[model samples]
Target: MKYQLYFDESNKLDQPNGGYSYYGAYGANASVINDITSNVISIYDSLNTKSEMHFREYKDDKHIKKYFRTLNYVLNQNVNINIFIVNNEDAKNTAVKMNVDLTELRKLFYVKIPERLFYGITRYLQSGTDVEIFVDSSDEYEKLGLYTKLKEQMNAHSAYRNKCYKVHAAIPLDSKISIPLQIIDTLMGIVVFLMEKAYKTASSTSKIKSDLIYRLLIEGTNIQFFQKQITLYKWEGNEEQISEIPVSQYITEFLVYKTQYDLQEMGKFREIMLRNPHLDAKEYRKLIEYPNARLRMLQGYFDEITTGDRNISIR
Candidate 1:
């Protein structure tokens, strides 16, 4: 078996913890990568823009629609999406505990995210499979060392050495033209956005919303894994529970704990959209513009959710 994993990072704005808080990868059989490219191109063809599709540039309803359609297609395919998130607070604590400088600790923790993501991918290989991994190109100096570090780590791991013939070193590719990278970019963006929501609210509702897509994809499947590790300094009001869980145990617990309640909620949202597929954006704009716009905008949301249409009677 041969696999290709395309990875990208999110929130790479030179933060204290080496820019990105999350790194993600989309992995699939090397043979089927072309099909993935074709599907993404098909969506691009429907749009009027000639420029590349980017997560940051997704600002309008049309862009949102394209993102969902493309993402839904990707999730339904034979691919795996794994994200490794760095808990900023956890890193700070770990740095302090180890008597290390925060800046050096941040860089070390940043390296660990990709290493863990790579390990998650390569650990599942059968006796004869080889893997190739690509990450979106970046100018950061740390990225320059990832390839060598990953190769050394894979070779050093006895499980990987025995289960697979060889693992190619991870390489960087320009996301501007790489469809697989773009797909992963979109996913990383969504995952990061969901994480932000989870951090801000600290509620089960937010957690469910964040995991909804992953739960839906993994239902009735036992031959796959969606690896997630979050070492938050705090969780569910427990600040002392900052230890990291083992990866396999974490995956198993995630699969078991997730319920289909969200599915029903998701189905309701689906129904609204399907029923009001023709709702005009202009109508929404009208309700949101001019006189007492704030109050009207609030009412617009209520009306849209209640009636499943943007044509609200603002009486």
Candidate 2:
């Protein structure tokens, strides 16, 4: 079988202290893509909106309702979604520790990040399957020789070396025509919104915390279909340093311990929304009170519920 991966990114690296941003990719076979694309076009027909679907541009109730339907389709589809979030502050610290200049850091963030994402997807490919990956149109990689770098990283994997899988190429495509890329755009937006909310939220005891700690917790159960199939990796430096104790687990446990009630309430609300489509005016009002409030608050709650407080490290 042949597979195609559609990827999109949210936010910019230059935005210092920008809470969270990600490069999210959606992968599936041709059959699944055709189905998803048909359903997406049907949604546009129903809404009668010529506007292209964009996560950040979704504002009004009508737009948001349609957006939610699109999100529901993504959750139910036969596809794999993987997100890699990089904090600006963390990247800076990593750069300082590794003694890398800004140019090197940029390559690591834009080029190396996607390469790791593809590596995670290799396990899903079987013998005789050819795969092509596309990202949203961008020129950042033009001078960096993205395709060449990607081949080097992808070919390094044992599966590719053993001829168990074939990578066709990496290319950039217009998001306007690719429904899969649009889906990834929404996915990345939701993850970023959740992380931002988590970072901005204040603790009960008024203690300061590291924002990166909340990154792992920004996962959602809607995509649990791809949970174990997906890998979330962090590139801190060139050399891997093993921590004596799993401090990340402790941080996750503390966050979950602190947000139990909020998570339960969000779960109950989610069930209600899913079952009852005709929410009252008051509910709609609540959803629109703040900017991206519904997605932001609910995702933060979902992240808390879905976050795994375990010990796992990537090399």
Q: What CA root-mean-square deviation does each model show from the true structure? A: 8.7, 9.6
lDDT of 2: 0.56
Lowest-lDDT window of 10 residues in candidate 1?
229-238
Provide the lDDT at 105 for model 1.
65
Q: Estimated TM-score per prediction? A: 0.63, 0.64
Candidate 1 Cα lDDT to native? 0.54
What is the Cα root-mean-square deviation between model 2 and the actual structure?
9.6
Off by over 4 Å in 1: 12-14, 17-20, 97-99, 110-115, 142-144, 158-161, 198-284, 288-315
Instruction: Please give, for residues 215-297, the per-residue lDDT of candidate 1 as tens digits.
Output: 33343332132233222111221243433333444444344443343344445544555665655535433433422222323
lDDT at residue 176 of model 2 (Cα atoms): 82
| Candidate 1, residue 103: lDDT | 60
